[model samples]
Target chain A: MAKQFDQRKETEYSSRDLETGCVITDPGNAARYKTGDWRSQRPTWNTLRCIKCGLCSLYCPEGCIAPNAEGYYEADLYYCKGCGICSRECWTQAITMIEEEE
Target chain B: MMTGKRIGMESSLGIAEAVKLANADVVAAYPITPQTHIVERLAELVANGELDAAYIPVESEHSAMSACLGSAATGARTFTATAGQGLELMHEVLYVASSMRLPIVMAVANRALSSPLNVWGDHSDVMAVRDTGWIQMFAENGQQVFDLTLCAFRIAEDPEVLFPVMVHLDGFHLSHVVEPFYLMEQDVVDKFLPRFRFPLALDPDKPLTAGAFFPPGVYGEARRAQDDALRSVRPVISRTWREFEEISGRSYKPVETYRADDARVLLLTMGSFSETAMLAIDQLRERGQQVGLVRIRLWRPFPFTEFRQAVGNAETLVVLDRAISYGGPTGPVCAEVKAALYSEPKRPRIVSYVGGLGGRDILVSEFVEMIEKGTALAESGVEEELLTIGVRV
Candidate 1:
């Protein structure tokens, strides 16, 4: 076959570095990993300290925590990355729950 | 009848002058602090058209390296300069430049890394990029830099060793030091190192693909090919360095072994620290200590065979690494040397000395202190953990 109008193949899988380029060398697989919303069984906590100190809600980078009944803290485990920063940050140490198997 | 004055310049600057002398086709760079002088002067040469090269102004160090890759692939003899963070930023392209087999030459001013952030003399930067497959050279002084800078192009462009080369100098020490050297005449340089023409390049007529994607099925094979190419570079490095000596009247070797012929304790070092270590060795010699220092010039290939042969008679091998592996006992070189020496039945007892890291000053006396610490371990006949050379606060 005669080659015509050759162009630089735009490889856009975007780990952006060659060392681990294989982590996303396959574009289709890379897209899946990117948009394939992860599932996690992280612990949800009832902040029984109940002092209503909004620290837990504010400190969660994931924003998984919110004010529940009586202004205690509650975590929505569905989207939590399970980084566990929330449990460690609870000043009163009122929230504790075990993780579930994946 | 005279022209430009004969002067020995810093290795990085020597490379810049040689690149200018070679009339490189492209000089792309991001302004990495320590490695700035090479690119800076090269930029001046380009501005004046003494060197007919495209001076690519890149935004980041990674882009700087990528520009060289692109330029070299397009059949231009491309060049670049970088240091610690810059080297880290360009880290991704280091292997690509090798696998694609572009004969790009770079000047790396070996500098300390950051956290506290320092811009001083050390091997931290180049050591961090140890296995990136580019032919790396350590200049002992300004003269080596001027000579090796020219030799680098000859070696990298040699069809047999068509790999990139990084001429390394310590940040402030060799990169900034001035010495006297017989500068190669431009016509002589042109005669010795001809224009680079890559056999496999991104030419329209050839329509070859480079840095292409490959599946897991063949990824390991491709890497193996790279390893094979690099492993075979030792001989090429020797031959080219000899050729360089023949033409330029300057000499070099893979590893420069000093006072090691009959020595019992051998100290291994890279970059500017080796000079200081030599002073320490002199002191130790006067004091009746059986010590010598081995300066590793060709780093990437690591010169395993030559290194093993060089330090053969030594009873104790003290490796002084400027950068720490964080968790590993020795600096990066010691670990690899251990792995290289693992199969050998008889080799020197290895002890690691970590010092001059993070821009800390490594004095000649400190080298003496390290030898004392190391020989102590050898006397006890125990393989000690990492030895910190100048760690006292």
Candidate 2:
């Protein structure tokens, strides 16, 4: 049986209060943890030359790219590591890699 | 107390029988000398319809322990057997099994490390893994090995104490020796050991991440939690032993003493040699020498309280170690014993001796002689740091 993760900050929990074996009881909890802060580069899509072949979404290492409401694909900056794989593999040169802004 | 029919069997086979009784779910092991017979017999049981368990014959000891880790993480009762070099091969994975809190029971046929290429019984392997974080227990005889192996499953699988356990028996000494011991009935064993249920097991429907990456921020806290969990398992070990005793007539203790009530001097030993020391103690007692014997059954978490109480009153304690520390102050076990008694207000004068290495025999006369020499050394206040017994000069 899976146990529920206690709703407390990791630093706030003492040794005794932590889960046994440091097991993260909440399944799929990684979605809640943001990794976009680790990005050194950002991916920008070019709408003019865009062919919504969805290859960018398919090749995302983090699987963080998806289609926007206008039927064009975009990278979800919240979870993306911005490895530039989408820009490197774009079929129609529709994506560009740019340095992440401060 | 319900006891099954008494039968003569090799200690390794008895261990296999104990695993069968415990109904272990998976046994992943590679054959290593002195420890081969255990897995061989287990493989045979699985080959037939007797065990009904998955016997994974791994490529090496490293994979053996790694496979056990996967099996145990899935909430399966797992077991494995290894020896000197084999134990060292799986050294790194031992930490993972304890840190992840998987209740894997391992049988170690204690053997001396290789260099001289000896496949004999010694505590060199056991001493090497002393800090690996698994609860360790040494068995003095075939009966104790069988009993402790059975108890290991119950102790490790306890939800409150979800750490691995190592049941150590001397290679070729206890593992190869054939002895008759009362085997508990299957129904009695079933009643004694509850079905294991790991609360946070890996399930596809309920996916919880185990052994997640702990950065520097939380790594210290995780280690502290593991340390506290290990130190707190002594009570569960005792309670499991007690519950096992209630069903079967066999009783066990952390630190067992023999004829030590009012003895002035005591001899301490572990593993199979403790039995021989007992005979030496009896001989000394018959000759009007007030001597006794103390055997340390529990090694990890170091049974500090029980050990202190067992050796507190003795004026001199002769500690017999089977492995050398190689240029250190004394044998590994002796150093620990001295450290354990250091803070006590009234502690015994400890004389350390390292012998019986690489499967060499330490005779009863030698034990008697060592005790007398230790007593003499303590009485004379001559501080000889380390003494090697039974060596031809």
Per-candidate TM-scores read 0.77, 0.90
Give the per-residue lDDT of model 2 (tens digit) for B1-393.
648788999999999999999999899999999999999999999999899899998899999999999999999999999999999999999999999999999999999998989999999999989999999999988888999999999999898899999999999999999988789888888987868789768889877788887666568888999999999999999999998888887889999999998999999999999989999999999999999999999999789999999999999999999998888978999999999999999999989999999999999999999999999999998877779999875
Q: List the residue pairs that clash in candidate 2.
A: none
* Model 1 agreement with the true structure over A1-102: per-residue lDDT tens digits: 212112212232212223211212222322222211343446455544646777777887766678766676776655556666766877777666455663
**In candidate 1 chain B, what residue range of length 10 has the lowest lDDT sum?**
B1-10
For B169-231, candidate 1 gives per-residue lDDT tens digits of: 888777777766667777877887887677656655545446765555446655775777777
Which parts of model 2 are misplaced by more than 4 Å?
A1-8, A37-59, A65-102, B380-385
Assess each prediction's global lDDT (C-alpha) against the native: 0.76, 0.91
| lDDT tens per residue, model 2, A30-49 | 67666897899999989999
